[model samples]
Target: MTDSNAALNAFFKDFAQNLGRLQKGADVIAGIRDSDVDVGSTPKRLIQRRDKVELFRYEPEVEQRIDTPVLIVYGLIGRYTMADLQPDRSLVRSLLAKGLDLWLIDWGQPGRNERWLTIDDYVDDYIDEAVERICRETGHEKITLLGICEGGVFTTCYTALHKERVRNLVLTITPVDFHADVDDPAAHHGFLNVWTRSLAPEDIDRMVDALGVIPGEFMSSIFSLMTPMRSLTKYNVDLVDIIDDKDKMMNFLRMEKWLADRPDHPGAAGRQWLRELYQENRLFEGKFELSGRVVDLGEIDVPVLNIFALDDHIIPPTCSKALAAKVGSSDYTEIPLPGGHVGLFVSSKSQGALTKSIADWLQARDG
Candidate 1:
């Protein structure tokens, strides 16, 4: 063949291969959309609801269930569905399989009217009611509290204020000491920590006031900005790489669905979080108060299991490691999982490790 003819053949071959891959990827995506790919498929009953807050109890799967039910407190920023992303990769399912009764608090998306809702409302009102209702139904005074990320901060506060209400505490990727970056520069690796710390208290107030209720998409965008290169590659390079693998593609899409489904945050609560915890670093100082009551971590003498993602960009290990020293609990344990923030719950390898560690720790203490 002539030089031009040879070049044309090579180009056509490459185009044909690329086209075939694109067609396969599109077919897989279409199938995923039409198929019964259920997320958060675990059965649960809504036992109680107060305003936007809802308390749900997952149906028991074991012959003999644990007396203490674990109440999961996911951050208000994202829905709790992340813990139950899919049947196989679900933290909920894993815990259920281990014979632990599970309960979850879903703080539904905040609206414009909810702009007035403060951190006190979440900690003092929603969390308080949920815990009491769980206690009332189970005929137990204290229940195991599992908090994730920002929810961990709230749980820590609640545990401190009402030590009698919590049997055991589990915090996953929780940022206990917001000023951790100040003490250790390694914690300053994440953009979120550095960005929030740079903002002034007045700046936080002004931003919150300007936005009646912070949009969930806005928050999602900020998280995406944390790893700009990774975010960009997910749509381009990563998607192409996993296009042929239907299982992997489905898992990726499921995670994308969860990430897109962010919840608007209450303006008042946002202001307090940014000002008191992020900006002023009042949490570590024991100066952060909810409804006039100080949230002193030293008061949490209950058994504590604090988990932090070693490779988490959003919440550095230093931010969560401080929990071991701050809490008054003699049975405090910190597990640094090998994954990113959200990956700790969904990643196949980490999911087993995460659930196993949590179950074993809780079993040893509660039994």
Candidate 2:
């Protein structure tokens, strides 16, 4: 055989390999079902419900190692399901395996009727009530409060107001100093802070009043703008890259499902989050108010553990690190983990470290 026969064979071999990959990809896509991509599948029982909020206690995965119960408080902007997005990648599962008595508060989707709900209501009323209920149910005077993102702000405010009810406060990817983003060196990090500041207070107020509730789609669009290239290529480039691997494709789909489930932010709360905190930098200055009471960060004297993602573009490290100087806790700890905002909980590398750190910290202070 000469060069002509060898060239022909090589061309056919390449064509056959490409055809096999395409067939496998097609089969994988065809087999995927709605349930295959379902997120937040960890088993949990509903403990109580109040208005749009519901409290849930996860069934124990192991014997409770610590006496103090742990309540996970996620922000209203996104669903609490994110903490338990999947069986293996779930923060809820990781902590439970460490013998934590984990409970979560779900701020159910708010409609137009909830437009009047403000930050004061979330911090002073709803959260306070949840804390009392947890105390009563667990027979523990004080429970550990683990707040994430905006929920961290709510928990911080609550701890400042009623420090006795909290034993340990764990904040994850929480921004204490909204304006601290200005100091962030990364171009991508703190776009939300800058964007929020670009708007006038009246502009935010007017948008909230006109819409009644901030639409989830609108918020999603703003987030997409922060990472425009990734958002644009997610379906095409990202999905295509993972299309041949079942596990990788499933992970991508589950994340997309979670992102699609964003809930509307209540109007009054949205207004305050944008104007009072992001715009005015009120929380860091101790000028933020809830129920006629100022939220003085210096008053949070509980054992506080602040965790922030080092590469978090959404909530810059500078924004979260600022909490250390303001809090009055004699026992304070800071954990800087690798990954971005969502990756802190979902990334395999970070989630294990995150949960273990929380468990160890809580156990040390459990007494």
Candidate 3:
């Protein structure tokens, strides 16, 4: 016979244990971006806040700083903070500490005005507009554009749509080619295509109409199903570990905070992207048209650096490798890392080597 008190104690004990885990911050899980943190008396240079994207520009103090200005384009599907996730495990921080001048685009939470915004709005209106702004402000003719994941697709389209404007392009863990099988074997396998497509415009409209913003958890669940084990098992492990870590707990909370955020994907824009990019694979074949211009891969005349993760389940090698043949630029090169899709930017194992390689490659071409 088991003691009733011991069983009840166990249930209540875990609740207390959960409280302890909530406080320890580990693995640099804190979501504070270095740029946003105002360290007392720290010299600040150029930081421009845009209506859509926040620009964080860090000036280099090293002698003879590189001439080419680097602009980072993070994925829009998630928060841009992943690049600067941890204090030690950040791409932007690492780049800045190395004396590289940088400007990052933080596409702010989309509002009602931005509803129905499409890839065209991202590539043509915002990115193109940002490129011109950066060029004019920095007194540079061209920019070294770096894009990741869906952001990479946006960048590639920008390169194709506006061939002459970009100097050098760097794609990190980008899904340049998504027509083939997904990198992950367990992903939804087009379940989203069917479900999202089957969703009537009114269905989408009813939700967004009822709710001012699209629920973040709803969007996250869609992505989380890609790796069922990740959602099921990862949380269990965290429950045990986070029992005593408030900071870690907060860090977890922050990531959860970011994960729960789901700004509405404009109804019209979402339909086009889901149908064209994912459904029909129009980007590679030059069939995609936006704002009266065709997105031809052959128009990518600038030098390009494509980085794909060998072990990434989200964007397999095939997804990015198609860039080798699709581009018109002779200066195309590809680097495949051992990290996963998001690990290319956030994980500790890849940060040092990957960031160095990126900077070195850009420097070689720009020089």
Candidate 4:
């Protein structure tokens, strides 16, 4: 073949590939327009509700379940829907399949009305009330508590305050030692920690007061900035790689959907979290208090399972691994899974192992 014919063939091949990708992209867009994409599809019932808090009990998939129900508390900034992002890739579904009775505490999007709400209200009132309701419904005095990220911090505080109520405590990507950076600056990863610590207390107060309720979009933007190049690369380079595969594209869309659905955080709560926990690094030092009660980590006596993402950019592993030394629990287990903060739960590669570890730990303590 002549050089001209070879060049023509190369051009034709390139055109065909581009044409195929465009057709696939069109199909994806059409599916989105038709509202065919679904997430958080697992069935659940609202067992109890108070203020903006809703306690949902997921329908059991297995006939036989552990006696102690597992209650999941998600971080305030993000919606709980990520756990049940899809039917096949849902952490809730996986746990339920393992015969674990699951429940979730949904702190609905806080508006201007909730500007006065603080950590005291969330931990003392909302979570306390939910736990009591769960006990009443299941006839189990002590239940398993699983907290994710900031939710883990809340659960750790709750378990410390009411150790008798929590049979087992699980914290995923939880930041326990706010000052982990002080001991080893190099190990102190996550731009969030450094950024918050760099801010003055008055600065945080001014920002919170002006906003009334911190906009979810503002928070999302800050997180995206942590890896600005990667965020851009996802849409520019990675999107094209998975566009032809419907299943992969759907998975990517589900994650994007979850990230886009961030909820506004209450102003008062936001201020307290930044000032007391992040800036002052008080939680581990027993200086943090909720409703006049000191949150002493040493008070935690329940079996604690601390799971940290090895490559967590939001919360460093050292920050999470500090739980074992601080908590008074004799049965403390720490797992360093391979993934980022969110990947620990949703990544197909890690979710199964993560789910199994949780279920097995809970089952072992069920008796």
Candidate 5:
């Protein structure tokens, strides 16, 4: 090679190395932010979803036994505790402060018994049972279900199947139409059609039989790839800030704890989601079957409120906004917030505005 060419190659090599260093540094910092070590621990209560499912509960309420209770259901992939971070910046606390009785659905660590847990089992069996229990406890026929992201679809499915149990419905950052033009295929590795659809119930069993519980790390890694460099960049940034402020370091550590604390999703439901929602676009098409029935959005007739983030990477507008069209609830309203998927619930910016808006939306249904 010529001398000029060699010099230019060396410069490019150094630039590549530097970029790698920067990304690695940030990932480390971001990991720190997502941990239990950095951020102060949250106050959580344990609720028995069944005799076994130990759902975590966080109540920041100074008052109790209100007229209409609030139930917050998080996505199956991530721990529910993400919504209950710091007291000063908590969705649970904010709802409680608004004088609403609150209950959070923490789907807890699933075991082998939960291995074959289908989306049917979750929406029909677990959620329906929980709603029934909550209703009996409060003596109210209906309860407000606030579902976030993937949970929103689950909630909508439940409402459609059993509208009698749901009074007011709230869906935030949920993806109903995975086949939307804007939905990011980056979240899943292969084409939604071939790989996921090829898998049968036996396939899911074998995959889980080989590994006791599917490692949350595998799922987290996929999410990290969506913003390949962001996690690394945040880690480096956290370390630098840790040099000066102790709270920032603590906060960073706490976030890392939460981020790392991903619970495994049951393989069967995962396979179904991959095949039905992502691959075939069943839910939006009114062909998504759960618990022996097709999911027709027209069946979701209760008062519904949909919340979307202006820039949610995990779920883009197409994934979230599609709900506006399918649901039969003419009493529907959509609120778009200025934040990313994760930031929509946790950021300080959401505290003053979006959180209050959430409570206000719930309050109108309190009567």
Candidate 6:
């Protein structure tokens, strides 16, 4: 009788607590507004504009400790806004607080009219122009080039070709060897690499020709397929678990906002990305060309800082770590952070380490 009574009391307590949580969750959901979930709230000023491409310099938060300005080059696939998602959890803010002068290129939303834009145009023209402008503005002969993902490929190529213009090179989650993922021990790692290699060259041409630009929706769908289980359960399971927590809910909504704002990739660039880089693996093989000149990775002799997420499924550790052997830099340094691709920038656990590592590395070479 005593055992039965205790069991009944425990069950009732759990049931009551669950009911209270459900009520709180409902109230939280009812109160959320678009303004309450704002992201990329860091202050910045646009300093240069060319067609759809714009360059912005972040306002310094402290006395600039580094004389050389650091230009952040984010991939065209995703917006640079990820670095500045929120004030407290921002890579931008943290770097600024550390007294680093920061600037970034915003490859503003590409459309049908921008379909003809190619990798050559981006590397030789736009990035070059940005570098020249930064040099003139800061009166520094060479500026540090910090690239993320695909942008790292561009910066690497740029550094190789124009070694005189770059003082330091920093790459985060950048894949130097597209085919390296085949050796990844984790089964789910490098889904993009496998999927891209599966498609024929003709298939890429057909898709680009038909669409003129790869729709953001199509790219988002591909990313979703990379983690099918997570895609299915994210809303129903993940969101529900944190619905009553304001901080977690805000983070979730901000990420969703960022994900939803994916820009359509220009057709010509998309074809080259999928074909020459992904399918043929030309970039790693030293056959990839930008503006009629071959991009040889070994030609990049600048002090290189390569950062990779240990469990990055998209880029994969093997793909990113391969840079250690390929670069000619005697000062090559690698940091393997714990988390997924996006988590390296946004996760609270990873942000402090990521920012501090970058600041300390850059400061060491600032002279």
TM-score for all models, in order of appearance = 0.94, 0.95, 0.79, 0.95, 0.81, 0.95
> How high is the lDDT of residue 106 in model 5?
72
What is candidate 2's local distance difference test score? 0.90
RMSD for each of the candidates: 2.1, 2.0, 5.6, 1.8, 6.7, 1.7
In candidate 6, which residue pairs clash? none
Better of 2 and 3 by lDDT: 2
Candidate 6 local distance difference test against the native: 0.91
| Model 3: per-residue Cα lDDT over 32-145, one tens digit each | 453443211122354666566666665554643457888888755676677766666777777766566677776777766766677788889888877888888889888888
Which order, best to worst by lDDT? 6, 2, 1, 4, 5, 3
Tally clashing residue pairs in candidate 1: 0
Residue-level lDDT for 221 in candidate 4: 96
For model 1, the stretches where C-alpha displacement exceeds 4 angstroms are 1-12, 34-37, 183-188
**Which residue pairs in model 2 clash with each other?**
40-85
The lDDT of each candidate is 0.87, 0.90, 0.70, 0.86, 0.74, 0.91
Query: Pairing residues by index, what is the TM-score of model 3?
Result: 0.79
Better of 1 and 6 by lDDT: 6
lDDT of 1 by residue, 1-367 (tens): 9999999999999999989999998887777653455677899999988788889999988854566889999888888999999989999999999999899998988888899999899998999999999899989889999998999998989999988899999999888788675666654256787887787767677767888777898889989888888898998899998897798888888888788889889999888888788877788888999999888899999999989888888888888888777889899898888989889999999989999999999888874
Looking at candidate 5, the ten consecutive residues that score lowest on lDDT are: 188-197
Cα lDDT tens digits for candidate 4, 203-259: 777878888887899889989988888898999789888887788888888888889
C-alpha RMSD in Å of predicted model 5 compared with the true structure: 6.7
TM-score of 2: 0.95
The 10-residue segment with the lowest total lDDT in model 6: 35-44
